[model samples]
Target: MKVSLITATYNSEATIEDCMLSVLNQTYPNIEYIIVDGGSNEKTLKYLNEAAEKHSNIILSSEPDQGIYDALNKGIAKATGEIVGFVHSDDFLADPSIISAIVEAFKAQEVDGVYGDLHYVALENTAKIIRNWVSEPFDHRLLRRGWMPAHPTLYVKRDLYKKYGVFDLNYRIAADYDFILRIFKQPNLKFHYLPKTIVKMRVGGASNKSLKNIIQKSKEDYRAIKTNHIGNWLTILLKNVSKLKQFKS
Candidate 1:
């Protein structure tokens, strides 16, 4: 199956090269890489232009956008592959074969989506691990306990996006959580857990960059929980408390 991988970038000259190189070097041959850049600096655009010149499958767009979620929505609209996934500017696949592995699981299990573990490494040194997010097999009941697959590791069929909907811009920091609750709650969809690390993300994402953002994320997360009708106020508390184990892992 052809997998469409999207990466949203803005002034990411420092890390965009690694991100693009990871996709360009994927062992899977049928990947259509789409980049939605939010008007990055000339330096970043230079790298993007050079990479696109060498790779025929890359489709890039550089322009002002509302936010990361807006860029992602745009990418989703442009995607024509059988499956869709994301590799953020601050992250890269764990290995060149990761996409191949994901496609294997999708076909073997005949599932609607496949997700795996994630590793958060230091910003300056990708080798230095900060936290490990090992996910479990999906059980709808897990949603009530604030369980979700790491967003970066999720790869879903493109049809699911059309059926459920795209990211809701109303949510600033917790849209991914909200989207997960929306699709995963559907009783008919089947998601398979691939028991391996799929992506390595750099630390310092927007949601956890400051105390204020954390507070705002909590508020939005609670709203998502209520909007999805999956749980109550205590669900948000369980969500925050669950991250503690990532540090220990």
Candidate 2:
């Protein structure tokens, strides 16, 4: 299956090239790389342009956007692949075979979504793992227990995106959380969990970058739980508590 991978870039000059290299080196030959830049004022565009020159499949667009989620929505709107996934500017595929492994699992299981583990690597040295987020096969009831696959490691069918709609810009930091709740809550959606690391992300994401963002994420997470009618405040509590175990992995 043709997979469309999107990466949203801002002032990502520091890491965009590493991210692009990881995507470009993927063993899967059928990926269409789409990059949506949020009018970067730094050297991010230079690196993206260089990558586009090397890989002709890259579709590039640079314009001001609402945020990372907005940029992602723009790329998703332009995606034509049967499957869609994201590789944030601060992240990279765990290995060249990651995409191929995901595609193989999708065909083997015939599921609507495929997800795997994620490694939160050190910012400067991605080889050093700071935290590991290993996920499990999804169950609707697990939503109440605050279970969710790593967002960056998830690849969903394009048709599912058409049915569920793109990220809600209403959420500033937790749109991925809100989007997951919106899709996983459905009774018919099926997911397969591959017990392997698919994406290696640098630490210090916006949501956990500061105390204020963490607090805001907590608020939005609870809001998502309530908004989806899946759980209560306790659900959010479990979700937050669950991360404690990820550090040891």
Candidate 3:
């Protein structure tokens, strides 16, 4: 199966090259790599241009976007593969065979989605491991407890986007959470959980960069709960706090 991997970037010159290299080096051969750049002024485009020349399967676009989700929508619109996934500018695949394993999982399970563990790494030192966030299998009851597979590790069928919908741009940091909840909460959709680390994400992402952003994320999480009709405000707040344990691991 062809897997489309999208990476949304903006001024990512500092770390995006490793992300690109990780994707390029994936053991999966039938992969489509697309980069949606948000009009970066730094060396971001320069690196992308170089990668575009080297990788025949790679596509590049540099333009202004509202935010990460807007860029993601563009990538999703352009994807031509059966299975779609994403790797952020500051993240990399956990292993060379991770994508290949994802394809095997899809072939074996015949499900709408597949996800696994995520390893949070120190930004200053890639060798330093900070936490291991092992996601639980899907459960309608867990949404009330703030349980979600690491967004970076989630991969779904391309058709699911057409069926359910894309990320709601209104959510600044919680749109991904909302999208996952929307898909998994539906009884008809089938999901598979792979017990392996799929992605290595760098620490200090926008959502958890500061206390102010954490407060804003809490507000957005509540909005996601309301918009998806998942639960009440108090339930959403508790779910957000439940994620704090991820840092301890």
Candidate 4:
């Protein structure tokens, strides 16, 4: 099956090239690499163009966007594969064979979605892994407890978006959490957990980079729990905090 890999970029020249290289060198060949750039002022677009030129499977668009979620929605609109996944411009697959592993998992299990673990690296040294987020199989009870898989490693079927719709524009940074809750926590969707590292992300991203953003993320996450009828507000708050320990491991 073909997998559509979408990346949302904005002045991400520092990490974009590595991200492109990871995908371009993938063992799985039937990939449609699509990039949605937010009209970067830096050299990000030039690198994006260079990568696209080298890989015929790459499709790119650079334009002004509302935010990351908006760019993701746009990428989703252009996706043509049966399975759709996103690899942020600042992130890369953990290895060249990641896509091959994902495809094998999907084909073997016939799952609607598949997700894995993530590693957050320090900006000064990409080789230095700062934190590890090891994900587990989906459990409905975990939703009320504010549990969510790493968004970068998550892959969903294109048809699921057609049925459930795209990311909620209301969320500024927590849209991905909301999207995962809506998809995996809801009824009747089959999800497979790949017990491996799928993506390596740089630290200092928009949502988790600062104390202020962390507070905002908590507030938005609480709102998501409320909107989705997950559980008691206080319990969800505690549940959200519990996720921080995942990084320590």
Candidate 5:
């Protein structure tokens, strides 16, 4: 199956090369790498241009965007592959074979989506372990407990987006959580949990960059829970508490 991997970047010169290299070196040959750059600096664009020049499969677009979610929505619209997934600018695949394994899972289980574990490593030293987000198999009941798979590790059929819709821009930081709840809550859809680390994300993402952002994310998360009829304030509380275990691991 053809998998479309999208990466949204902005002024990411420091980590853009590693992110691009990881995708370019994927074992899966049938991947359409789409990059939606948010008018990055000259240095970042230089790297993007150089990589696009050598990789025939890469489709690059550089322009102003509202935020990461907006850039991702643009990528989704441009994607023409059987499956769609994301690799943020500050993140990279755990290994070249990760995409290959995801494709295999899609075919083997005949599921609508597949997700795996994630590791949040130190920004300066990716080898330095920080937090491990090991996910579990899908169960609608788990949503009540604020359980969710790592967003970067999720790969779903493109058609699901067409049916359920894209990210809600109203959510500044909790858009991924809102989108996940929208899709995973569907009764007929099936998702498989691949018991492997798929992506290694760098710490200090926008959602957790500051105390204010954290507070805003909590508010948006609670709104998503209420909007989706998943749970209440307690659900949001559980969600925050659950992250403690990731740090312990």
Candidate 6:
């Protein structure tokens, strides 16, 4: 199966090369890499220009976008593969075979989606792992407790995004959470847990960059839960509490 990986970048000259190379070097031959750059004046545009010369399937557009979510929507619109996934500018695939394994799982398990674990490494030292987000198989009840697989590890069908819709631009930092909730709540869709680290992301993402962002995230997360009718304030509490174990691990 062809997997379309969408990468949203802006001024990511320092990190986006690794992200792009990770996809370009994937063992899976059928990959449509779409890059949605947010009008970066830095070396980001230059890097993509050189990559475009070497990569025939690299569809790139550099323009100012509303935000990362909006940029992702643009990537989604351009994606033609059966499966859609993301490897953000500050992240890279775990290995060359990760995408191949994801496709194998999709075919063998007959699941609607595939996801694995995520490793958050120190931005200053990508080799030094700061946190591990190990995820389990899909269970609808888990959503009520605010449990969700790592966003970067997720790969869903393109049609599902069309059916359920893309990220709500209203959510500044919690759109991934809201999007996952919207998908998981459905009874029809199914997912397979690949049980391995699929993506390695750098630390200090926009959502958790500061205390103010954390507070904002908490509020947005609560709104997502309440708006989705998955649970109330208690769900947020459990969701926050669940992270303790991940840190401990």
C-alpha RMSD values across all candidates: 0.9, 1.0, 1.2, 1.3, 0.8, 1.0
Which tens-of-lDDT digit does each residue in 99-149 have in candidate 2? 999999999999999999999999988889899999988888899998889
> Cα miss at 91, model 3 (Å)?
0.4
Candidate 5 clashing pairs, residues 3+ apart or interchain: none
**Model 3 TM:** 0.97
Each candidate: what lDDT?
0.95, 0.93, 0.91, 0.88, 0.95, 0.93
The digit string of per-residue lDDT tens for model 6 on 139-248 reads: 99998888989999999999988999999999999999999999889999999899999999998999889999999999999999987889888888998888777663
Predicted structure 3: lDDT: 0.91
Residue-pair clashes, model 2: 0
Whole-model lDDT, model 6: 0.93
RMSD in angstroms between candidate 2 and the native structure over all alpha carbons? 1.0
Give the Å shift of residue 186 in candidate 4: 1.9
Off by over 4 Å in 4: none
lDDT of 1 by residue, 101-172 (tens): 999999999999999999999999899889999999999999999899999999999999999999999999
Estimated TM-score per prediction? 0.99, 0.98, 0.97, 0.96, 0.98, 0.98
Instruction: Give lDDT tens digits, candidate 4, residues 1-249.
Output: 999999999998888888888888899989999999999998999988887887789899999999999999999999999889998988889999999899889889998999999999978688888888898998888777767889999988899999888999999999998888888876789889999999999889888879999889888888887777787677567766676776644
* Candidate 4 colliding pairs: none
lDDT score, candidate 4, position 124: 67
**Against the hidden true structure, what lDDT does model 2 obtain?**
0.93
* Model 3 misplaced regions, further than 4 Å: none
